[model samples]
Target: MKKTSKKNNNFKIPGTELNSSDAERGKKESQSNFVELLPLEVTSKIFSQLDIQSLCRASRTCTSWNHAIRNNDSLWKSHCLTIRAVCQREIDDDVKSGYTWRVILLRNYQKSKVKYEWLSGRYSNIRSPVSLPEKAMCPMDADTWGEILDAELEREVEKLQ
Candidate 1:
């Protein structure tokens, strides 16, 4: 039978045993050192200025940030309103459906992107009705369709010039 040495038998897991220096380092690494130090109003104001992508990233950073972003419906409402300029009908539908501002934005953000691509003529061939996103056709009225068509025609005319 092989006998393990006493020194070898006593194993120290790297982080399980913390010396004074390690404890100090751990304290320094806490989220409260930065974000939590700010007043809630200040944090909300800062997050309100961030764009959708930045706000989403910030929400994932920590519990406090998530709470700040989630609880402030006005912040998400402002973003939803901004996106409404690009996809008004979709935003209206989402509002009618009783979705919260955050949910409304999530639901329409992709649809708005696709609609913008179509309006800007980013796709070379928007040939068939099937080629367009389902949501694009559903909520858009005849007037909105006319506007989109006019915009596309204007873009084509600009390209020709």
Candidate 2:
């Protein structure tokens, strides 16, 4: 058997060495934005499928993703409508006031959660603030409080009868 030369001792397995061509290709792949590869309509449709939490998490992953998510108001609109089921007046007011879907959602998300709990009687039996769920309270407008109060009264009436 022929012996290998010392000069050839630095043998790298084929394709193991990252040559200029490989480096350039890898760089191109990394630099290519997934959002840019697709048409905005397609990207919006794809992102529209993501849930609110998933959309939010994906937005934080990269600037491109964030831009793609932020530029599509329809994506936010669907989630806002889901919240509107719980806070109808609040959402309607915001929409009528010319607020963007994203802004409307951000403004009402926490309020909706707290309001839903109250309206659903989740907190109907609480005797004091100490008995409330931790982090369950949010500042809501008078209309929202009125709705909650009305719900509580209805619950009381149901109990009385």
Candidate 3:
């Protein structure tokens, strides 16, 4: 087997933290208290500016950040209500058109004689009184939909960050 070459030291990728000096800075950035630097007002603005998806994404970055975001029920509730509003449109349309149309429009969501479900979490079945779409979108049980939303929201927020 060919042995690894060391241009400087530490055997790290060349030009990328190959030496102790570079590694120290890399560690410093991760350790930096960037979160603490932002004041509460600024943080609240940033938080408010963030839609539900952004807040969820921020929660996945690390333990401290996740806990902070999760604790903010207002943010989560806002997200839930927003999703509910969007999906409620479908239900309203379904009602005007008829139950038969509900089946066709929500074909992605299969239905049994018992009930209807959306196989696609991105889409939702409108439940009357209009519950949150977090449950509606899943083609499967809400257990799966919850996971899907959690993952999707985190991804969206990370991309923005």
lDDT of each: 0.74, 0.85, 0.48
Root-mean-square deviation per candidate = 9.7, 8.6, 18.0
Off by over 4 Å in 2: 1-27
Better of 1 and 2 by TM-score: 2
For model 1, name the residue pairs that clash. Answer: none
Pick out the ten consecutive residues of candidate 2 with the lowest summed lDDT: 2-11
Quick one: ranking by lDDT, best first? 2, 1, 3
Per lDDT, the best of the predicted structures is 2
Task: Name the better of 1 and 3 by TM-score.
Answer: 1
Count of clashing pairs, candidate 3 = 3
Candidate 1 TM-score, C-alpha based: 0.59
State the lDDT at 79 in candidate 2: 96
List, in order, the clash count of every candidate structure.
Answer: 0, 0, 3
Q: Can you write out model 1's per-residue Cα lDDT over 4-117, one digit (the tens) per residue?
A: 232322324676976555555555556243456667778778888899999999889888778878878888999899879888887898799899999998877776776677
TM-score of each: 0.59, 0.80, 0.34
Model 1 worst lDDT run, 10 consecutive residues: 3-12
